[model samples]
Structure formats: C-alpha cells, structure tokens
Target: MQSLDERCLRYLAEAVGCGSVRAAADKLNVNASAVSRQIVQMEGQLATPLIERHRRGVRATPAGSLLLDYYRRQASDREDILAKLTELKGLRRGHIDVVLGEGFVGDLMSGLLQGFWARHPDLTMTLDLAATNDVVRRVVEDEAHLGLVYNPPPEPRLRTHLAMPHPIRLLVRADHPLAAHPGPVRLADLAGHRLGTMHPAYGIRQIIAAAERAEGVRLDPVLITGSIGVLKQFVASGIGVTLLPAFCAAQEISAGSLVALPLADPGLDGVEAQIVTRLGRQLSPAAGTLLQHLARGMAGEARSGTRRSSSSR
Candidate 1:
C-alpha cells in the first residue's frame, strides 16, 4: 500500500484545529470542497464519522480529535527524521531555532553560539528572545529546536540539561553609597534605595521578590524594565542599582565601569540555565555536534568559576 502524503495529513490536522472545512481550506490555500472530500475519504477509510457538524462550524468527534493528535505527532517525528538525515550529509546546513530568555541572549548565549558558528559556518541559527514561559512553550510544542531557559519547565515530554549556574549580584556605579557597605546588608537597608529590575514575569524577578519578602521588605523600584542591557546602562549612569547575573556584568565589572556586590542574607544564589528540548526530538547532525560543544563549554565555565553549577547534561 502507498504511504499517506504529508499534505493529506496536514489538511486533516488543520481541519480539526480550525473545526471548519472552509476555514481549513483557506488556511491551506485550497478549495473548501477539496478539504471536505479529503476529510470524508479519511473518515470512510477509518469507518467512522470523525466530526460533528453544526450551523456555525464543525467540531472534531472523539475519534477525529485523536486522529488529529496522531497526525501532528507523526508530522513532528517525520521532520525530526529529515533533520537527522540532512545532518548526516556532513554539509553543516539547516536552521536551528532557539528560544531564549531576555538576559540570556547576551553573554552566555552569545559566547556559546559564537564558538558554535566558528565550527559550523554553514549552519543557520534563529534566536527568539522572550520570557521563560514563552521559551518553554515553544520547545514543548516542537516549534523550536532548543530553548535556553532560567527556570525548568515541568513536562514529561521534555528533558532539561543544566548548562550552567549564573551567580547573580547587585550592580551599581562605583560611587553608589552601598558600594562601601562592609558586612551583610539588611533588606531594610534598601527601604529607600532606588531599585531597578525586570518585569515580574521573568523568573529572576520572582527570585528577587521572594528574597525581599523573606526579609519582610517591600521594594519600591524606581525602574522596572524588560531589557537587561538597558538596566545595566541605568545602573552605570547611577540612576539606580539592579541585580544581574555575573556573566552579564563581567565586561563592565572588569573594565571598572560598574561594581557588582553580592547581596548578603538572601544572596542572589544564582540562576540555573537549562537547555530544553522535546524528549525524543531527533536532532540534526549539526545540532548534535553543537549540543556537545555547548556541553563542553558549560563544563569549562564551571571549572573556571565563571559559572556556578556544573553541567547537568
């Protein structure tokens, strides 16, 4: 027997998703009648009515919903197989999609990917900068090949590797009053201090908030911005002090451009960086090689004290 074509499976899946034959046809750029006939034929082959019709639209029957899920999974598996085959050609080509959190796009990801590019010059990479939840969602849905996230997502279909742990610290200009503080600073010490941080949606923000709450302190941030780079600039200009990962503060701290001090008591222990992908997503040959390179880099960083945690690979 001949195998089912991808287009047919795709049509069925889309029809189920849209719940209307006409809508699926529009999405697929085909005639409504064609989608209708194909779905009817598919149902006939299965010997069941796959959908329930209504005046406004159609909805998938129990059987239709199951079939749609199966089709989608099969499509994802087929793509993985194709990606693997392409890698075996040793051509070092094909795009790798990465979803990363805001601050992650800077030093860590930049350094790791720079080395990767040097080795696989022909491979293309696309990075999507977003919040942690967004990154995990993309990876879980197989919309991205890999994800760099601060917080691990809890999903049975996903696996995570601890790439590194970033030692987070409070940063300020050299002349900031807190820069001269000697011992463990109490959270109450920051009562009137101008705090700058990311939106509460980011994991780091939650970590910061929890620390403050534990000390019975409530911060009145003078600035709340999403961009870490911009926050660094604000701190450098003496606008306000902010907490940031050490790696992100490295260059400025080394250049005498900023002073990063560890917060005492509930110190910014660090943010855990994780590499997440679908549990069984077959990586392309190039992707596999890059993953190994990243693992090595993480190991090296951990050894050098540049990163806080060892590889959880």
Candidate 2:
C-alpha cells in the first residue's frame, strides 16, 4: 500500500489552487524544488504522473485528481471526529452555521443570538442571510448546516426538522384608521389605501397577491421593494401599510411603532416557517442544541401569531 502523508496533500492542493508548483511553494513558504521532489516521490510510489507541466503552469493528471478528492474527504472526516470528541469531553469546541431568509434577521434574531452565545461562550455561530429560494438551495447543497425559511416548496434533498404556522399580517402605523379595528383585517378594507410590500418573487408577496385576486381588489403598492427593512420603514411613514409575517414585526408592534392584523381569508392557511437541513447530514452537538433552541422559540411565536390572527376587533 502506498502511504501518503498530510504534508504532500497540503502541498498538492495548494499547487492545484495556485496553478504552478513555484507559486504553491511561495505561498507555503517552502522551496519550489522541494515541492517538485515531493510530487515526484508520490508519482514514483503510485506509478503515475501527478501533474502535467504546461506553458500556463501545470494541471492535475487523472491520478492527481483522485488523490485530491481523497485529501478533501480525509479533512472532512477529521473535522467530524473532532466534533464528536468535543461533544464527549464537553461542548466547548464545536461550531454552528445557519442560513436563513433575510426577512428573518431583524431585532428578534439579534436578541436570540446574543442570549444563546452568552450562555455558551466557547461555541461559535455564523448567520448567513439569503433569499428563501437561495436558503433552501444552499441547505440542499450542504453549504449550510441549517436553514430557516417561510413557505418553502418541497425538495427531495432537504429534510424538514420543524414547521410552524406563520400566517401573513397587515402592518399599519398605530395612528392609522385601520389600527382601530379589533379583529382581523380584510382585503376589502384596504381598498383605495396605498400599500408598500416586497416584490413578486418573495413568498409573502405571493400570499398577498393570491389574497388580492380572491377579494377582487387591486392593490398596486405605492412602493414595491425587495427589502424588509425598506418595507417596514415605508409602512411606518403612515402613507401606506404592508403585509408581513407577524414574527418579523413583533418588535415594532410591541414598541407601538406599528400594528399587526391578520387576514380573515381561509385560502392562506398553509403558510409556514420551517427549519430544514440536508437529508442525511448529522449535526454537531453545538449545532444541535442551537437548532433545538431556535425551533422552540419559533413554535411559541407561531402559536402566539395564530392567537393574534384569530382575535376580533
């Protein structure tokens, strides 16, 4: 059996990335001849050329490609072993990576992340804000450890960990006349009212569009934006109202800056905020704990939203 060490793997990977043995040596702070010698030794032992020298630099031969894949997998396995070791000893060294919709990353997540980190100071967390489609795609591709998105379509490569009802709500300034209503708001009530909302591609916008079509009303928003922050600001200006997920605007509603009202229509009941991950991946202990905590909060918030949506004026 031909035994390959980590040093050769590192040098080869760097050489491939840099496209030249000399450049790889410069980056690794070693002599170019030394890197060439290592490659030659490996080729002699394995009975194949690892690199093909060319005018533009060098390219990996078929055998070298196989070795590179092995090296990549070996690194991944090592990380997994370290994660397990961390769990067995204590939850001190493991980390988590989460990708979620941009709309889900406001004041609510800020507080939750801070509180979680305060308790587990040694564990690391990464937040990647993306569109819902991109969030699901990235999770399916194993680019992220977990995902939080609303109204995601089914994907075979993804597994749903938790799903909670999260119906859309009307966001209006507290001083707006519509804020006087005690019950859920209806589309007809919004006739002639200027509105601000996200663009057509967003899930919330799709829900709003479907509702508008059913009510036989036309709501050409005065402001069409792709930014949740921009929509919130526009609604707060008292010139228009925007519909959003109740949890997304929880802070503004509580602060009396805006009011939340649910739609009375039954056609929009399937909307949900879901937690997802790659179908076959195992989460690290730190990631698992973080996922569970986020899931619990989502469930509680969803239930509260349901109650609010059903309230009467």
Give the top-scoring candidate (lDDT): 2
TM-score of each: 0.77, 0.70
lDDT of 1 by residue, 1-313 (tens): 4455556667777776687888999998999999888878777777778788898788888987776666757766777678787867774667777788766665555488788887788988788887777777778767787887775546787787555776567788889999887865665777777888888877678778788878778888889987888889999888888877766666788688788776774545745777777787777666667667766776676676543324321
Q: Record all residue pairs in model 2 with backbone atoms less than 3 Å apart, i.e. clashing.
A: 182-312, 182-313, 183-312, 183-313
Q: Give the C-alpha lDDT of model 2.
A: 0.80
User: How many residue pairs in model 2 have overlapping backbones?
Assistant: 4
Off by over 4 Å in 2: 1-81, 106-110, 181-184, 303-313
**Where's the lowest-lDDT run of ten residues in candidate 1?**
304-313
Summing lDDT over every window of 10 consecutive residues in candidate 2, give the lowest-scoring window. Answer: 72-81
Write model 2 residue lDDT over 192-279, tens digit each, in one string.
8888888776777877778889878877778888788888888887778988886687788879899887678765656888899877
Clashing pairs in 1: none
